[model samples]
Target: MIHLVQIIQRFVRIPTGILAIMIYTLIVYLIYLAFTKYIPMLIHQTFDMIQSVIDFYEHQPKDADPVLQYIHNYIERNDFFEQLQNGASIALGYLQDIGKMAVAFAMSFILSFFFMIEKQKTILFSRLFLKSEFSWFFQDLYYFADKFVNTFGLVLEAQFIIALLNTLLTTIALAAFGFHQLLSLAIMIFILSLIPVAGVIISCIPLSFIAYSQGGIRDVVYILMTILVVHLIESYVLNPKLMSSKTDLPIFYTFVVLLVSERFFGVWGLIVGIPIFTFFLDVLKVKKIPNHSPREIDIL
Candidate 1:
């Protein structure tokens, strides 16, 4: 471990501007590939899966489940092909939003590059204005901003680790079950798992639906149990261990904050709520308060 650390330190001491540029270029190329290839292929596979489901229902015996019968009747009445076309169109719209995101990423990269190259000048300029009559106010503001940004970054890092683990576990399980489109499903789960408490529930829907389409209730039940076990591990083990030391919030309280924030603020609330709550808790010194004596508690 000491040798490894020394090696890493030696590598870190090397000049990295060219390396950063190469990495950035590679990331841009990968994003382009996702847009031009992977996404379209995923869409095609999804449509194929839908078609397979339709074909399966078409050949089913008269003694099929009432729910499946109703679905077949509805698809027949509405024209499954037309519905598929509409769904595809909607998906294409979502893809356009990805293009917009790519543009934003490019802009951010450029801005960050400029900032990195001129970091000293940027600091000097900020200090010129900040170290003034209202220096105390600006200093306090900067401290708060720094703390908040650090906390937020740490939280995102922890969440990303959780998402990666979840995706890996999900991919292995899906493969064991002989599920098709394992790559796409794993990618989807990883993305969704970036959201807090409700992300698992959202990811389960498509997984369960696909399982049901493939092998009916038995497969769905198996997938559900797998999801339950994984979710339990994530909630009870990974989340507490990763976040507790950083946020100083109990797992139960963190969950409560997530639920309440989502209820009031919608989907984005799930992403930002816990970090914001933790930031406030830190700023307010909530955790630092000592336990009160019985007399003090009674007075309060």
Candidate 2:
């Protein structure tokens, strides 16, 4: 044990310790910079969407006036008055969800700050605090933490890039369809992209309802078809291709995990489920647990 301790100390001596500290500091600084630049952008995009929706309704032609006769005619022909009421309800719910999401995301960023800072201390303390027989186990735990961070970051970066691209494409499609409140739709897409699997569908509901109210059911169907095609491309082709470039998990596994998480946690589950699963898997590897993919779960 003394010889092993001596070897460990010799390997990780002052210079190596200094290098680790420098690397950790660099990472924390980069994270801070990223958070600073993006948080305001996200907030701006959200408010812009809400404002656009409000303005669209505010400026709608007043009823029964000849100059606005076309809108009244369309609205009556499609019986969109009732639909508009329903849409208002949906929009209100979406707005509330957006507010909640903003709060949750802010909290996550704050939590991550503490987690990142305490990580090195946790590593050191584990070694010092563990029994000699369990010292190697603690070292394995630290190594797993590093690997999980690397994996999680890589997945998040790649997924977010795909999400941004999809948002851009979808916004263009909405404009092509002549949908009002284009910016709002785009922002919704961007926010939904953070969620896995069902995010797109959930985000689409309010936008599609608004589209239906303004245009008609047929127009809504067309928009839905377009969005579905985009989602197909995203789920089957883009997601797998991007994820494969980084990790080897099968597409079925991702789908199954998303389903289970959604069943359990609703929207929140969809956002955090896979990351949590991966983190647990990494920990299981550290602890030498037998593992199964999400597919094998028997909900019955």
Candidate 3:
């Protein structure tokens, strides 16, 4: 965001910190809009698709194809429509949590804004510990913290690019297949793509349902395949190259970090797991901190 702030600075002269926070607030606002709007669309599409299935099951001829009949019979026996209703209700319930997340995200940016504006004071005050008796401990702490920030910042930059690419590819694929509400879908994909492995799966489920409503099972299959291909490109081609250059970790290590972090820290872990692991590596002197980094703590 600070990089973006600098870019904007060329065209307009404004306080950098203020501009950065303005950008952050704008992003959060967009995310809030997505949570409010797209979620309802997802549920509505899902409900419509499920209702169509129920209608077909009800109105099908007595001599309908046996396999198809058997499938619809299974759906009925499982109380699938009722389950979908309950699921929709539960999904709606999550809107409260989404509100909380948006508030927290906004608050984090506010804190960051203050920190940016007070960077000199923050650094000087934080550096006072260098002369403390437990300076060794503080030094170690700063070492790890610097590594984490630098690596995390780089990964975030790369992730934004990856998310943008993923959104464009997914949108084009959906558009080619003649999907509807594509603007909403593209926004959701771009947001979810920031979340690593879990993001792909989370976005896929509702998207698949929406695709089903648009063009039945075949459309769902295409949507799944498109997501899979995009994810493969992100995980293998993009992430490995970017992360390996920045953190010196193999893709295997990255996956392990993600899995372990996800187990312990849930969703937040997927976002930070690689950075934390790289911090440990930097502490152990197994990974070298990149010379060009966004953090000032390293030299301090």
Candidate 4:
């Protein structure tokens, strides 16, 4: 197994780094397009929802509550449509910034490509710059890098598997619920699922809102329940099994790390916290060894 991994890493190191950069670029581009194209439609949908509520209240009986009546009148008096238009115009400027970001990413890809090709030269240059007093520091850094790569790579593999499964299940559920735009929603969910606990919560809001818009409060309740169940499964079953298969940490430890990291660093902490914790555990040689009798041979 070690030999196979070494061989695979030897062949894939450069390609993997390049591929990672490309994937990041693609994700950024997709996000830019989604924001530029879909956000206006979403805003329009929200406006329609507001308008629908206002219209409903306008046709209500004369005995309607004074508070509700005041709210409805206030909505009618506001220039919501104009405000939405202005918001869309502001959003277009962000799209221009996204274009600049894409260009920067392209330059980064070029640099990474050259770095991959001249990896040996880069290592030589680093060594030449280091003083003899810092030799031990460099050795420790190398050790940390090796552990990080192996541990983090496993975590990524497990996460990819989880994300794919989550996407498939979410797509099926959306289709069953007769939701429109399954493809885009599924893609969004898959990408968000790569984040961690907060990702599931963040995805639920838009999904529930869409359900409410399409099929009322009951549909929203159903969608929320479905998401809750899926998240439970991911948290209790999939994450523990997959992460433990790669690293020795227990499920409880994983959750604790996620919570603490999120408290400190917010969303990005959730994404990287587990792998970072796993790398440290490995570096510290922490393991869970089973306690057994000396005659614990299998009877079968």
Candidate 5:
């Protein structure tokens, strides 16, 4: 058996490895394309909301506005109209950025497909460089690949379901509390949740501010608390219980990975960071990379 393994290893080379990498990259790009379908509409609605805010402030009833002197004063001092215009511009820019990424992702996916097909000969030849004993490695590797893809798809499906649930709950909560533009805000939150850490902070900030402006301090506090509790349950309870039924990570490292990814890679990093980290960690375990402690694997 050991001798057989040795022959297999010798045959492995760059072509096979590159092919594998390209395939994996194509899969990721496809996922990104799927995400893009929803983002543009969400962005359009968000921009519309900004326009509405601007109009609301601009057309304040002149006489009544004087009566509500506090509101008038605050709006004036804040330059709410100008802020609204700027907000609209920023929102539009964000939408365009998403469009650009979507296009790029599509192009990359196409390129990878062609590259894999054209390099078939090269891919076969590259495998010849591997250590002779490792021929069986590819068989073991492909077995794990099949299993990993299945498990990963399930995890993504679960997270999507939970995110949708959160969106529904938040929208209902906002509507029940009489938030005027609940639909737009709810949609934004739904889209943002897929982004991970930065998404959490970004979506929450707008929600909190909307609650403050449209309702009051009490409403804002209530909204914040509700979201906080929901997130806690989602992160601490639902994730471990449902998503990571077999294994889980410590909460501390989850936060650390989130923070590090958010800081370094912005929104995309935040969304994908944990999954990538887990993948590498798993690979380390498989390869028995020296001095690397094996982490308990989790589906994120």
Candidate 6:
């Protein structure tokens, strides 16, 4: 936040607080747009994708390929569409819960904006207590408290950037292949890219299915190759550079954290499990995430 303020200071003269407010307001607006616009579109696209697949299965020619014929027969025999309807209803309820979370996030950003604006005053206010007879107690409390928040924030920011970049690159590859439903697929990619190794594998199943539906086995091979390349770049290039080295746990640990966190915190645990773990590590003074990372510094 301070770095952003400094960058803005060079362009036009403005009070630090006002600039901070402007930046944060822009962030809040983006968050609002994401929840109100992009997320709803993603949800609708998901439903459409499912419905279209069901329609394709139901309407296939009697003399269709053997595999597709078998798949269609299985769906018909199992009443798959009815099962999907039930799942869709449950997913809708989850989306509504997400809407509630958006409200909570907005409230948090608003409160944090006030804190950013009054940061200097808060520091001075704290210094008075820090210099008192109980200085050591207050100092340790304040230091650990601030470090915990920043550690979580750093990990979350890194993950978001990595996901966004992965989505963009993969979407470009799909577009180059003239894939259908690119917008919907891009949104899905972004959501799944939040997970680590397993996300790419899971995303591949749907992507390959869609690719095959569009252009047979040839397209499936092409998309699989694309996914493989993206996965390699994400794992080897993005993770090491963008992610904090401090939280650079092994693949086994990442999966374990995801599994345990998912069981305890539901879906969100997958997204936040790493960040929470990094925070605890910070509390132990185990490792550190640099304050001015190049990735974010280059952004503004």
Q: Across residues 52-158, which tens digit of lDDT does each residue of candidate 4 receive?
A: 54456557658766655675577568865577578789768756866886799778766755654555566567665344587778767755665665677667667
What's the CA error at residue 28 for candidate 2, in Å?
14
Every model: Cα RMSD to truth: 8.4, 10.5, 4.5, 9.8, 10.8, 4.1
lDDT over C-alpha atoms for residue 186 of model 4: 73
Model 2 misplaced stretches (Cα beyond 4 Å)? 1-138, 245-267, 282-300
| Window of ten residues with lowest summed lDDT in model 5 | 291-300
TM-score leader: 6
lDDT of 2 by residue, 1-300 (tens): 112223455777643344445555676688787579865676676566656655654466555345245654676688865786797898888779889987997787566545444645654555574446776676667556555654565566657777887888888888887775565567678878877666777767877766755566766787788778888888778877776544345668767888898899876677667766766666666323222222111111
Candidate 1 vs candidate 2, lDDT winner: 1
Stretches of candidate 5 off by over 4 Å are: 1-45, 55-97, 100-144, 147-152, 195-202, 245-247, 263-265, 286-300
Worst 10 residues of 1 by lDDT: 291-300
Clashing pairs in 3: none
Candidate 3 per-residue C-alpha lDDT over 73-98 given as tens digits, one digit per residue, 9 for 90 to 100: 88879998789789779867766657
User: Each model's number of backbone clashes?
Assistant: 0, 0, 0, 0, 20, 0
Residue 81, candidate 6: Cα error in Å is 1.4
Candidate 1 Cα errors over 4 Å, as ranges: 1-12, 54-59, 63-103, 120-130, 247-266, 287-300
Q: Distance (Å) between predicted and true CA of 59, model 3? A: 5.9
* Candidate with the larger lDDT of 1 and 4: 1
lDDT for predicted candidate 2 compared with the true structure: 0.64
For residues 1-300, write the lDDT of model 6, one tens digit per residue.
655677778899998688887898788789789989987887787778777776776678777787777777787898987898898898888888788887998788777678668877865676787788998898788666666657887778888888999999999999899886777999789989987777888899989878867677788899999999988888789888987485788789889989998999888788888889888777776766665442322211
Question: Higher-lDDT candidate among 3 and 5?
Answer: 3
Compute each candidate's TM-score over C-alphas: 0.73, 0.51, 0.70, 0.54, 0.56, 0.84
Regions more than 4 Å wrong, model 6:
1-3, 10-13, 25-44, 132-137, 285-300
